[model samples]
Target chain A: MSGGPAGDSAIVVSDLRKSYRGRPAVAGIDLVIPRGEVFSLLGPNGAGKTTTVEILEGHRRRDSGDVRVLGVDPALGRAAWKARIGIVLQRSDDLTQAGALTVRDWARAMAACFPNSRDPDEVIELVGLADRRNARAAHLSGGQRRRLDVALGIIGRPELLFLDEPTTGFDPEARRRFWDLIADLARSGTTILLTTHYLEEAEHLADRVAVIVDGRIMEVGPPQTLGGRATAAATVRWLSPDGPRSVQTCTPAALVTDLAARFGQDVPGLAVERPSLEEVYLRMIGAPA
Target chain B: MNAAATLVRAPALLAVTRARARVEFLVFIREWISVVFTFIFPVLLLIILGSIFHGQRLPGDVDLAQYFVAGMIGAGLFGVSFQNVAIAIPIERDIGTLKRLAGTPMPRSAYFLGKMLMVAFVALAQNVLLLGIGSAFFGLDLPDTVGRWITYLWVIVLGIASCTMLGIAASGFVRNGRTAPAIMSPIAIVLQFISGVYFVFATLPNWMQTVAAIFPLKWIAQGMRSVFLPDGYQAQEPAGSWELDRVALVLAAWCVLAFLVAVRTFRWRARTDD
Candidate 1:
C-alpha cells in the first residue's frame, strides 16, 4: 500500500455536533487522529460514540463542525472517498439474508464493491474462517459471523477503518484473537478508529485512548497515563505487629524502602497496587461501582 | 503498508451491479415460499376461478375463463413487481442490509437497479407460468399476430416497471419488515378487485370504475385484454373500445411518476433512523 503523507491525519474533527429530536447526541467535540494509529474511543452506552463514528463514516450528517476523513470532508464524500474507508457497524449479519451464501461467497460479493480488494480466500483465511469457507453464513457461530464482518471491512483495503463495538458478543478467547487481528492490521499501517465498552480492550489494543461521556471527551492519552493513572497514588500494605497497615501515597517507592527498614528485611504480606485503567475510567464516568 | 490499503481501487459500477443482482436472484429463488407465492399461487388462483365460471359468456361472447386469464396475468405482474418489492426492500432495511450497503462504495442507484433487475426477472418468470397454465388448461387465447405480440411486450414491460417502482416507493411508508405484509397485501387485494381482475370492469358500479381508472393496474389489465380477446370483445370494455394507445400512455406516465417517487422516498436506513 502506498502510504499518504506521513503528517496527514487519517481523521480530523472540530466542533462536531449532532442532535436527535432536539436532544444533543454528540455535543460539540474535537478530535484529531493521526495516520496509522490504533485509537480507541471508550464510553458507556448512549455516550455518543456511535454518533461521532457515524459522522466520520459519512453515514450521518453533523449539525455543525468541520469533519474530514482521509483528507476529504465526509459530508461531501463521493464514491472515491468512500472507497478509501471501511466501516464495521455494531451489528450486521447482512449475509444472513442470503441464507445459502457461504463465507467465501459473502466475502467475494463484498470484495466486488471496492475497486481494490483482497482475494476472497485470503481474507477468509485471514479472519480464521478458512475451515468454514463453504459453511453458510447463517450457520456460523456468533464469533465466526463477527469475523466475517471484519473480513468484509478489510476486504477493500481501506486506509482508514472504523470498528464500532467489534467485540461486544465475543467470548474471552475470541476477543483476544480479534484483538490480535486488529493489532496485526495496525502494525501494517492501517489507521484504526475503534469504539468499545471494554476498557481492557482499549488498554490492550489502543495506541491512544479517549474517554467520552455524555457526548464530551473527558480525557485523551495513552491508556496507561489516561486520567493521570500512571502517576496516581498507589496503595501500600504490609503486616504489622498489630495486624496490618496500609497507606495511599504518591511516593510508593519511598514508602517501600521505609517499610523494609522498619521490618529489618522483609515486609510481611507486602503489596503495592497502583490504580488500574478501569478504576480511572469508572472514576471519570462517575459510576458508583 | 497494510494489504487492505494497498488493494484499494474503485470497482466498476457494472461489476458491482451484476454481482449484487446475481446474489439477490440466488437468494430470492432459494426461498421456496417466495417462489411459490410469486409464480405458482397466482396460477392456482386463476385455475380455480377460471373453472368456476368456465363457460360463462361476456357481452361479446368471450368466455369468462379467457377474460379471467387476462385479469390474472395483470394481477400476477402486480404481485411480482409491486407486492414483492414493497415487502422485500423493507425487510432488507429492517435487517441492516441496506445500512450495510450504504456504508460501501456501491452507489445507491446501482443497489436499486440491481433490485429492479431481480424483480423484473421474477416478473418474467411469473408471466410465463401464468400464460402456460392459462393456455394448457383453460384454452385461453394468446396474441396470435406480430402486432398483437408487440403490444403484449410493451404492456408487460411498462406494467412491471411501473408497479415495481410503485412498490419500492410505497415501502417508505412501511414501518419495518414485519409490518410490510400487513400494509401491502390489503392494498394489493383491493386494487386487484377494483381494477377488474376478479370481475368485469363495465359491470362494476360507475364510481368504482372511476376509482379503478385512476390506477395503472386497470390500464395494464385492459392492455392485456386487448392483446388476447377477439376484436368484438371491445364492446365489453368500459369505453366500448380497445384503446391501446391510451393504455400505453397511462402506464408510461405511471412508470415515470413512480420512478420519481421511489427515488425521492426510498430510505437506506431502518425506520428508526434519525
Candidate 2:
C-alpha cells in the first residue's frame, strides 16, 4: 500500500496554549513531526501529552497557537482535514457501543468517514483481528479491543495517526504484534505521533522521542541519547566477594582496564551500561522510581 | 481538492445519521425493558387508569378517561422523544460516544438530527397507540381537523427538541454513565407527573401549575388536549384560547431556548474527559 504525498513537516506547533477553568493543561508547547517518521511523545500521566495530542488532532481548540498538521491548521481544520488524521483515544468509545455489531461492520462504518479508505478486510488483517472479524466488538478481549481501535484509526488510510497509550492493556505478545503492525505502517510512509508511557515502546518504535514534563518538553532526540543518556556516566557492575558491587564513572574503559589488571581475568558478571530510555524518561519527568 | 470532491466529502452527514438512527432503533427495540416502558407500560397505565376514572367529573365536565388519555398521548410523545434522549444521550456522552464521533469526518448535527427523526417517528407511533387504545376502550374520537393533526405534530416535534437539548445539557455535565438513569429518571418522573401523563395538571395547586408551565412538557400536553379534547379543555391552555399558532409559537420558543443552552453547555467529552 503506497502512502500519501510525503510532507517535510507532517505537523508543526508553536506556542500552543490550552486551559480549562484557568488552569493550563498544555501551556505554550512547541512540536514538529516530519513525514513518514514514528515520533514518540513520552511523559508520565497528566503531563499534557494528551492535551497536546488532542489539539493536534483537531479534537480540542487552542487558546492561542500557530499550528499545522498536513499543512493546515488543525484549529481551522474542516471535514477534509480530519479525514487525513486518525486518532486512537485512550479508551475506544466505539468498543462499548459495539454491542452486537461485528468487527467488519465497525470497520466498514469507520471507512465511510473518508473519501479514500483502506479495505476493511485488509485493515482487519493488519490489526490481526481478521480471525474475529465476525465477532462482536464488545465480546472481544482487551487486546482485541485495542486492535479494533487501531483498525478503525487506519481504515481511513490516514496520512497522520495519533495513538494515545495504545498498548496500555495489551499482553506482551499482543504488544509485540502491535509494534510490528505499527512498524509496517510507518514503513509504508504513515506519519505516526505516538504517546506512550512505555519507554521500551519509545525505544523500539520511535525514530525520535520527546519527553514532556509538567507541560513542557524537556528533551527531544533519539531515545538512545535522550538527555545525553548514552554519554552520561556509565555504570559497571560485577559479582564481588560481598555480592553485587557497582561503580559509576565517566571513563568506563579505564575502569574496565583497571579491573582487568587487578582481577587478571574477566571480572565475574562484568557489565557496563548507560541509562536506559526508561531511566532517562523517569529522570526527565522527575519521577525517579 | 476541487469543489466537486469537497462537496462530496462533507463528512458523510446522512450516512452517520442514518447509521446512528438504525443502531439506536435496533438497540432500543431489542431491549425488552425499553419496549415495555415506552409502549406496553403506557398501554397498561391507560387501561387501569381508564377503568378507575371512567365516570369521574372535572371542572370542565371532561371525562377523566378522555383527559388522562389525551395527556398520556402528550406524555407518550414526551417520554419516547424527550425522556428517551434525556436518559440515553447523557449515558452516551459519559461513555465517550459523542466525543468519539466528533473527531471523525462525521458532521455533529447528524447525531441529533437522526435522533430528532427517531423521536418524531417514535412519538407518532406512540400517539397512534394511545389513540387506538383510547378509541377501543375509552371511546375517544380522533381529531377531524387536518389543521389539528398538523398542530399536534408540531407540538410533539417542538416538545422533543426541547427535551433532547436538555438531555445534551445534562450530558455535558454528567461524568458517569451509570449515574445517567439515576439522574434522569427523577426528572422524567417529575415532568411526567406535572405534564399530566398520569393525571391532570390543573388538579395540583395553582403554584405547582405555574411552575410546570415553565417546561414545554406541560405546554405540549395542554396544547394537544385542546386539539383532541373539547375547546374548553383547560381554562388557561396558553392564554385561555386553543390557538394552534400560539402553541406552535410557545413550543418553538422553548425549543430555541433549550437548543441555545444545549449548544453552550453540551460537552463532547465527559466531565473528567476520559
The most accurate candidate by DockQ is 1
List the candidate 2 regions with Cα displacement exceeding 4 Å.
A1-7, A17-28, A61-65, A97-105, A119-122, A227-275, A286-289, B1-6, B30-40, B57-62, B143-154, B169-183, B201-211, B230-241
Q: Report each candidate's C-alpha RMSD, comma-separated, in the order given.
A: 3.6, 4.8
Report the lDDT of model 1 for residue B8: 48
Question: If candidate 2 were superposed on the true structure by all CA atoms, what would the RMSD be?
Answer: 4.8
Alpha-carbon lDDT, every model: 0.87, 0.79
- lDDT (tens digit, per residue) of candidate 2 on B1-274: 5668666766567777776676567557655666677657777788888889888876666777888888777777767766677777766776666777777777778778877877777776777888898988886778899987887677776777776666666665655777767777677779878766677675677777788877777778777787778766657353566656666776788777778877887767766652
**What tens-digit string does per-residue lDDT give for candidate 2 at A169-277?**
7889989988998999999999999999888999999999988877888888988889798789999998888899899999999999998888888799999999887
Q: What is the TM-score of chain A, computed separately for every candidate?
A: 0.95, 0.91
For candidate 1, the per-residue lDDT at B219 reads 92
**TM-score of each model, in listed order:** 0.93, 0.82
- lDDT value, residue B220 of candidate 2: 80
